[model samples]
Target: MARVRVLMAKPGLDGHDRGVKVVARALRDAGMEVVYTGLHQTPEEIVEAAIQEDVDIVGLSILSGAHMTLIPRVNELLKENGASDIVVIGGGTIPEEDVLALKEGGWAKEIFTPGTPLENIVEWINSHVKSKDN
Candidate 1:
């Protein structure tokens, strides 16, 4: 199987990085090459890194209740840079309504919340990204 590339980022002022680090490690252990951009990233920086890394997925880790603003900004930046094929997903404290709004705003995938198994994320990427490659 081809290795999937994922750029995981922490956008905004959320300095709490334990979750993002854990997820990044899990993704790497699952055989995907993971590039983690440390805390305090802007939407522009995240999108730029995703494009430069040529990743298959751009996963944002936001816990500051700013998913509404950040997710859409990243999505727009990706579209502007012609990196719309890069799947944009997230994991944060966002509400269900916000998740639906993000999907509607072109996030390609839904945000994973607390208690969501790492296996589920791994499986989702395996299925979705692999299919995209074909």
Candidate 2:
């Protein structure tokens, strides 16, 4: 099997990047190639990076309570660009109530809330992301 390539990005105006950075490190340590697009990335920017990097997954870290707006835009852009097969996962201060809708809406395949273990993130990616070469 090939190594999984993941693009981790922070969309919108959220400057809080500590959580995403930690997860980026964790994913890197787990043997995945991680490209972290730094603060204040728009949905289009994130999608472009995902395509440029040719990543298997696009992980968004949003804490500005704009996951609803940002995630779908990214997802829609991916579909529009014919990259919808790329898995989309997110982490940050998302509310419990919005988790189900986010997943069911096909925007975010998974949503990791605060206090979620890094190992869980690693495992989820390992289980879900099929390498592009496969």
Candidate 3:
């Protein structure tokens, strides 16, 4: 099977990237193809890149308290572009209460908060995300 292709993005005004860089490295180390879209990316840019990359998953890192806006917009843009098959997930300073809505709304399949084990994230992706080539 082809390796899972994942697009890792930092959306909105968040400037800190150390955590996302670590996650991207971990995902890559896990044998997945990881593409990181640097910092201050808009939702549209992220969606376009994910679709263009043919990624199985779009993993967004948000820390600007704008999860409500960023995640949904990305998901919506993906759908509008006929790439809704690409799963969207996120991580960062998002609050616990919002997790349910993000998942229920189908905007994000998962959301990892600060302190979540890196191994757990890797395991979750291995189990949940299917490679597009499959």
Candidate 4:
């Protein structure tokens, strides 16, 4: 079986990236091919990377409290670019109420707040995401 390919991005002007880096490492360690887009990326850039990389999932990390705006933009751009099938998940300093909205609004497939176990993240992808070839 092929490994799942993930594009991890930090969108907007969020300068705090320690947590994202950690998640990237954890995902990599879990045997998924991880492509991290680094910090301060626009939703367009992120979607472009995800398409170019032929990734199965897009994992966005935002700490700028702009999840409501950024996450939806990324999802919209993905659909506009015809890559809406690429799963978009997020992790950040988002509030609980917004988490529900993001998911309910279809902005994010899943939103992981702080304190979410790395295993849970890996497992979510393992169960939910499949390599495109599969």
**Candidate 3 Cα RMSD after full superposition onto the native fold (Å):** 0.7
Alpha-carbon runs more than 4 Å astray in model 4: none
| Candidate 3 segments exceeding 4 Å error | none
* Residue 79 displacement in candidate 3 (angstroms): 0.3
| CA lDDT of each prediction against the hidden true structure | 0.87, 0.93, 0.93, 0.94
Model 4, span 3-115: residue lDDT tens? 99999999999699998999999999999999999889999899999999999999999888899999999999999999989999999999999999999999999999999
TM-score of each: 0.93, 0.98, 0.98, 0.98
- List clashing residue pairs in candidate 4: none
Q: Which lDDT value does model 1 have at 92?
A: 77
- Over 1-134, each residue of candidate 1 has an lDDT whose tens digit, in order, gives 56889999999997979888888999999989999989899999999899888899988998999888888899989999998889888997878888888878666487898889899888888877852444
Task: Give the least accurate 10-residue stretch of model 2, judged by summed lDDT.
Answer: 125-134
Q: lDDT by residue for model 2 over 15-44, one digit each (tens)?
A: 999999999999999999999999999999
Clashing pairs in 3: none
* Displacement of the residue 83 alpha carbon in candidate 4, Å: 0.6
| Ranked candidates (lDDT, high to low) | 4, 2, 3, 1
